[model samples]
Target: ENNEVVYELLADMGWTGDSIDLDSWLPVYCKARYGGCPAAMDSAWQQFRETVYSSLYSYPRFTWQTVVPDTRRISKLDVSDSFLQGVELFLSCADSLESSPLYVNDAIEYASYYLAAKADDCYKRALKEDSLGNRVAAMQQLDRSVEILLDVDKLLASHPLYRLEEWVDMARDWGKTDLEKDAYEANAKRLITTWGGFQEDYAARFWSGLIKDYYIPRMKLYFSEQRADLDRWEENWIKAPWHNTSTSFEDPLQSAIKLVERYKGE
Candidate 1:
């Protein structure tokens, strides 16, 4: 039963069936290491952690405590500045669109929402201590996430899914006699204006709500150490003159951090 439960948990976490049965004793392991379990299932997880630690750290010089660094020094995520900037950019554009505005405006508004959501997600990830790093890196990743969201948003807004003729036809249908004359005019005008403004608005957004509840508090391990910035970082990393034979000096963590930084830079 213990083995089965362990296997099931692992499978749920995306582990293949080939791994060991470490689930049943997890809570015990947790208690021994982390003091206690918040829930019944955690008991098994605690035990499993101990088992793995014992197996992996049995060497004379190995120390489990040292391997997983004492997390006491880990500070709370300080993504306020970067997150604020991202949210500001995201919401400023998002809040301006009226509902049923021109199709182009709608597209731009939708893209803005998408970008904001992504930025929020990145900020939350940066706050996760288990997955977080130095302040600079965290800020950088947050910025990068926003920039990508904005760029892609604008790109999507500019290249609308439908052509101008299709949009005009749609506006006409919505502007029929049943609709108020003012309503028709307003809707038609909005649609037309949006056709041009979509490119300008790109990823516009409404105001951002407060920054609380943006990230998971306890489950920090799910956050990423890699920079969220892909385009610029990849360009630099791949094209660097010194990247030829120095795998030892290749810092994936730093590269990821740099990407996030560059994202904020723009």
Candidate 2:
């Protein structure tokens, strides 16, 4: 259960049968991890369960995270009201949850997801603007999308679990020599970026350094009509020196509060 963590896989073996009653599981999991669960958080988790624990989503990413900035992707889900309500309820308890690493990390994670949804909206709007021949308007929307992604990267930096620097640093630590360190670091970057043919973004993650370093530039190149040497450009980045500077907000809870109020229900 711990290793093969996906319940969907267990369903086929009749181990899960179907949904594993999150109502019963969440409170216990919360206690084990955070010592206690607030009523608001439980209600928020129930609201979120409609989107997360309710289904077996095949893709872990949104349309904006695709290899190219195409808006035709099937996983383009509209942000649901339940998800927004959950976010509101979750943020309402920020004062209570701020001290717990697990809670703070969850706040960062949830905020990042909401921001990604907002970014996808901008992405879709950009494409629509382009279709209407509004080049300047389209670029504005595209630029806004990029801004949101950078914000996401910043938000995720405060999170221990989702930060790209954490992954890359662990890769570097696995090496006994400088050459091996460079190789391992390159592998780590590649796994998140060009994870090989036909699977370039199958497991796309919106991590801190990854968003600014990889996705930001990819979106620009896609918009600039520079399709010729994109693959080589990615290779260059993979083999390049590890010089990405990690960044984060000092008070992630307050940062989250500002972010939520700024783009609430957008």
Write candidate 2's Cα lDDT for 52-157 as tens digits. 5556445557666774453333453435778877877887777776778777777777777887888888887887887798989989989988888888888888
Q: TM-score for all predictions?
A: 0.21, 0.85
Q: Which runs of model 1 end up more than 4 angstroms from their true locations? A: 1-101, 129-133, 149-266
Question: Which candidate comes out best when scored by TM-score?
Answer: 2
Candidate 1 C-alpha lDDT tens digits along 1-266: 11233454555568455554555445444344334434422432343334322332211110110112233333222233444343333223322322223322333433333344455556554455225557666556555554544343333333334223333345446644744433543454333222233231111123211011011111122233433443333233222221111011132222222334454433
Error in Å for residue 14 of model 1 = 49
Model 2 pairs whose backbones collide: none
| Per-model lDDT | 0.34, 0.75
